[model samples]
Target: MKIAVVGAGLGGLSFGACAARDGHEVILIDKNDEPGGVMALAREGGFSFEQGPLILTDLREDEAVGGFLASLGIHLETVRDDRGLSTPDFDLIPPEEYEGPDWRKRRLEELFPAEKKGIREYYRFYDALMEIRFLSGEKKGLLNQLRLLRAFLTVKPYENMTCRRFTEKLFSDEKLRLVFNGILADFCADADEVQCFTLPFVNTETAFDKRIPTEKKGKLYYPSYRYIVGGCQKLPEALCAYILEHNGRFLSRTVAEKVLVEAGRAVGVRLEDGREIRADMVVGCGSARDFFTELVGEEYLDGNYRRILRDFRPMEAVFMLHLGVDFDPSAFQKQSLCYYYGSYDLHGAVEKLRSGVYHRGSDGYLIYFPDRHAPAFAPPGCHCVTIYTVCPDRLREGDWESRKELFADELIRLAEEHLPGLSEHIVAKKIVTAEDYRRLTHMKKSSFGGAVPIWKQRNPPYLTPVKDLIFVGAQSESGGGVPIVLLGAVEAYEKAIRANRAEGKGPAAGPV
Candidate 1:
């Protein structure tokens, strides 16, 4: 079977690699000059910076992402890593001494003496969820099922609570509540909009400190964060190389204008240059609304899919400044990446973001040192820093291109509160706004991440109503994150291959 995949992001690359490896003719189409979309590195004046987050999860050899890559004979060096969190009045920095895994709980109790009882109770709930997570990852069997059920029963009382209600129930101090819910601002979601069960996973203690043990009693307890030695681009590069080696083709710098369908089945893709490539299967990713309405035509969509496209909410964009400095920022900021939150009102911040109000990094912003991991990203005597915060794709007052520089200056000024003399040492800089992301991701309103983790929200599914046309990516049902997209794409490909076999369609020119 010949397959044409649109948008050579991680989703398309992973799917193409799988189909090509299975002896199918695979062709990947992307508008970018390179394969990886946001994973692609940005270079300015000898300084390199990744457009996405540096720390990832589940890429170890025994993990889901790593196991899949090993199957394709592709492996890259990975380093264990973690991030730091801070607020205006407090910081969650790991101590130099190796504290126990439950150190955060003890520290929180110390900081908020009045809420010590609530803190202890919250950790109990967190432990129950962690046990459920571990059991769910076990091999499927009657024993595992019963074990998972027993674990789930511990926290069953809070199953229906929203993040806001649960946090209010736990901590009386608003600052203490922000410790768990502040991360949701990155998704442009309100605490009331998300499920309480996601709080522990999103605020995983292991992610805040690398010293925390991920293995307990010879079994994986909590997931450890990791980073690709070179950068995240390595993952996409490896997948693309595998596809090419397997006799597949990548049409870079080419736009896939439309998905051609006849008699309710996708037949091929129409390129922007007025060329059409026929294929047995068509896979797509990007803005679900844009792709369905403009490329595939909404008339062909079923009522259920159309309803999801209308109701599902994708996240807003981000404002970032990548700089090359003459000093080592690590001298002041210990962690390579630190989230500096200026405000504790996460709900107000998220509302402002949705209403076209830019916080200018006052709510929260992160400063990352890419050079610490990828030393070659800067000159021998220099280092690199990326200061960024989430913002709306469109502003109510003015456009991004017109106000991006001013906003960048304001964000840098805010970051200066943490890194003294930050502006004086900058030798080079690159500012990225929502406008740049919109053009790069090919969406009118760029969603920096995928859909917000709203409870009971229905994202677009991989298997569409139209036969032979599938969807995969951050925006797909798999949701956002590096491990999720990589694993989800492979699963989608397997389903597609199975469907083809059921339809009596095998490889185009080889034995299946």
Candidate 2:
């Protein structure tokens, strides 16, 4: 079968790589000069920085993502990493001495003695959920099913509570509540909008401190977080190389103008240059709104798919400032990355973001030391840093390009609170706004991540109404995150193959 995948992001690349490996002709199209989409490296002066995921989970050799890459002959060196959480009055940074997995629980209990009872209760629920997650990942078996059933019964009482109610029910102190619900603002979602079960996954202790063991009693108790030794761009680069080695083609700097449909089946794609490449299957990724309305024409979509496209909310863009400094930021920030939240009002912050208000990094921002994992990202005696926050893709007051510098300066000033004398460092700086991501992702709205992950929210599905046209990526039913997208792409390809076989269609010749 010949496959034409639009948007050379991880999703498309993964799908194309799998198809090419199976002896199918693959064609990947993207507007960027290179693959990787958001995973592309941003270079300024002599410094390089990652514009996408900071730390990824489930890429270890035994994990789903790693095993998939290994099948494609792609092996990337990875290093363990963690993030720190801080507020104006307190911080949840890892201690210099290695603490156990229950460290965060103990610390929270200490800070809010009045709510110690509630904190302990929450951890019990957290541990139960973790057990369920661990078991669900295990191979199918009667024992696993029995264990999962028992685990699910333990926390069944609080399953329906929203994040807002869960936090308020657990902690009376506003500061304590933010500890769990603060991360929701990053998703551009209100605490009341997400489920209580989401609390543990987002606040995984292993993600906050690399020292926390991922295994207990010879079983994987918690998920491990890792960074590709060189950079995230390595993942896409390897996939592209694998695709090319298998006789696949990439049309970089090309725009897919439309998905050609014939007899209710997608037959090919037409490039903006008026060149049409016929394919047995067409895969669409990136910006569901753009893919359906601009490329696939809404008339071909079913009512449910169209309703999802209209109702589903994609996350807003991020404001990233990459810097190359003469001094070491690691000195002040012990960890390579730290999430400094400015406010405890997560509900208010998310509302402001969706309403086209730019917080200028005041609500929350993270400081990441890129040179820690990838030493090549900086010059000798120098280090690279990225300070960023999730903000509105389209601002209400003025455009992103016009306010880019002001927002950059504001973020720097806010970061100075964590790294003293940060402004005095002579450095190279690159400001990335929503407008830049808009052009990069080829979306007018420029949602940095996929969807907001709202509870019961409808997202674009992989199997579309149009036969032979499959969708893969963050916006798809798989949702966002590196591991999800990679595995989702493979699953989507399998689904497409199954659908083709069911329709009695055999593999076809390569596209001309």
Q: Per-residue CA lDDT of candidate 1, range 1-512, in tens?
A: 78999988898898888888878888999999988888888889989999975788988888889888998898888988888889989999888787988888888999999998889878888888998888877789998788778768867888999999999998999999999999999888899999999999989999988988899789988988988888888899999999999989999999999999999999999999999999889999988898899889999999999999999999999998999999888999988889999899998999999999999988999999987878889998999999999999999998999998898899889888878999999999999999998878888889877888889999998888888999888888423888887878888888777776787774444333
Residue clash pairs of candidate 1:
1-507, 1-508
- As for candidate 2, its clashing pairs are none
For lDDT, the strongest prediction is 2
In model 1, state the lDDT of residue 498: 72
User: On residues 353-402, what C-alpha lDDT tens digit does candidate 2 reach at each position?
Assistant: 98999887878899999889999999999998899999998999999888
lDDT of each: 0.88, 0.89
Off by over 4 Å in 1: 140-147, 506-512
